[model samples]
Target: MADDRKVALDAALKKIEKNFGKGSIMKLGEKADQKISTIPSGSLALDVA
Candidate 1:
């Protein structure tokens, strides 16, 4: 069932990370949904314009 599939997928992901190192694979939805905070460029002209 879905639970079994999820278990298998988790095992595969762990194996991949163990061999390739962490953050070698990223889940798109998780990355895409993240909010990026913007900061000022610190230039007067750029900030005004």
Candidate 2:
């Protein structure tokens, strides 16, 4: 099971890199960081009613 999951994950990453170009993960992380930085801290809220 673990091996299967690893294989699937690797395949997905390769696909992403192919579609998005090399260093895509690092690019995504940088974009995410920029977007997250814009959000006000402590703004997240969850309601369980």
Candidate 3:
């Protein structure tokens, strides 16, 4: 259902936010070498498979 999807999406967003909030700096893979000031603290800047 749409409502269920929305709730699930919200939960996912919260997880991503929490992960990014950890403030752990990481090196990019061979292909990627970009920088971002802030993320939600330790999450990836891009979508993973």
Better of 2 and 3 by TM-score: 2
Candidate 3: where are CA atoms >4 Å away? Answer: 22-49
Q: In every candidate, how many clashes are there? A: 0, 0, 10
* Candidate 2 off by > 4 Å: 26-49
- Which candidate's lDDT is highest? 1
- Candidate 3 lDDT, 1-49, residue by residue in tens: 9999989986776777688853333325534345756545455655331
What is candidate 2's lDDT per residue for 1-49, written digit by digit as tens? 9999989988998999899977666534354434322444554553211
RMSD of 3: 13.5
In candidate 3, position 35 carries an lDDT of 71
Better of 1 and 3 by lDDT: 1
| Residue-level lDDT for 29 in candidate 1 | 65
Model 1: lDDT of residue 28: 67
- What C-alpha lDDT, on a 0 to 100 scale, does residue 34 get in candidate 2? 41
lDDT of each candidate versus the true structure: 0.81, 0.67, 0.59
- Per-model C-alpha RMSD: 6.3, 8.1, 13.5
How well does candidate 3 match the true structure in TM-score terms? 0.42
Q: After superposition, how far is residue 1 of candidate 3 from its true place, in Å?
A: 0.4
Error of 2 at 32 (Å): 16
